[model samples]
Target: MARRRQAARAAPEPIRATSMWRVDQVFLTRKGQRVEVICSLVNDRSGLRNLSVIAPTEDPREAVRHAARFIAGKGNVSTARNARVRWTREQSTTLQDELVRDEQLEDDFQDEFEDMLAAVRDQMR
Candidate 1:
């Protein structure tokens, strides 16, 4: 029994590294009926909860590393603040794979702005 106990103690435990505070496995409800969605509904899953991002291009692992280093009082103080945004495994590919604009968009609002103003002004008269 001593040998068995020692062997059991020697066995390594599984490690699950994650920052997920909580995850609610929700189901679809429509017209008082519960629907078990089977297909990989990518669009439906993409949202602010765990799926949203500040800088979608940035790697969450780097942020984790930065936060860890800051928490340990080794890295720069700004490291934790700068590396604020974190993404789960579900958000990684969806964000990384998508194309994001880097340039400033042209202001075409002026075209409709005058028309809308005029219409509003006319409505008030």
Candidate 2:
């Protein structure tokens, strides 16, 4: 009975996890001639966050404006439309490769933290 209870109390790890948004598309459009649009989303504790149609320009001022708008939802058409947008098939594969690299970095950080914790505990002992 105690064993079963212990197992039940143990938290289940995430089957899949990503710590950052995957860049869906990067576009330099004619309408926004000097601007490049970036689209991406991140899923975290707050829920899935959507960033759409960020218009970045080579000019410093425009780039700042674009970043602010992107963060503040000025160009989030998909979220307003109530859609879950996805990247192209090719982009998805590329994002998967990037995610693998990110996972390795995350693991490395976790290992470092564990070592630091062990050293602290040793000092306490």
Candidate 3:
């Protein structure tokens, strides 16, 4: 007697949420002799609706880059496919005030950023 064979099953694909990000404003604030760069990021797809990056740098470009990297490194990729980066002259006082009030809750993610860079370097090698 011949035996019947079972068919192979395919694996299910992973669900990925693409994040759409908008960089609304990039402003500078001076504290004593040092200048701080603040960038506002808005994401409607994920829970990170409104996010801000405060970098103690004189260059606004650097601060914006940091914000992009932060979004990528922090798993905020749900709507990253359609990223809009625009500089607006108007600053958001509400966000700035919130940042100042919650200074203790601020996280730079420097170590995580470094690790991500290292991983990419390793992959290239």
TM-score of each: 0.17, 0.25, 0.36
Report every candidate's CA lDDT: 0.26, 0.38, 0.44
lDDT of 2: 0.38
**Clashes by residue pair, model 3:** 18-78, 18-79, 19-78, 19-79, 19-80, 20-79
Model 1 Cα lDDT, one tens digit per residue, 1-73: 8888897776675554422121122111121222111111121224223221122123333322222322323
Better of 2 and 3 by TM-score: 3
Per-residue CA lDDT of model 2 for 47-119, tens digit only, reads 4444434344554234333533453333222221121222234434575643332233233323433454455
State candidate 1's TM-score: 0.17
The window of 10 residues in a row where model 1 has the poorest summed lDDT is 74-83
Colliding pairs, model 1? none
Angstrom error of the Cα, residue 110, model 3: value is 19
Ranking by lDDT: 3, 2, 1
- Lowest lDDT 10-residue stretch of candidate 2: 75-84
Residue 42, model 1, lDDT: 22
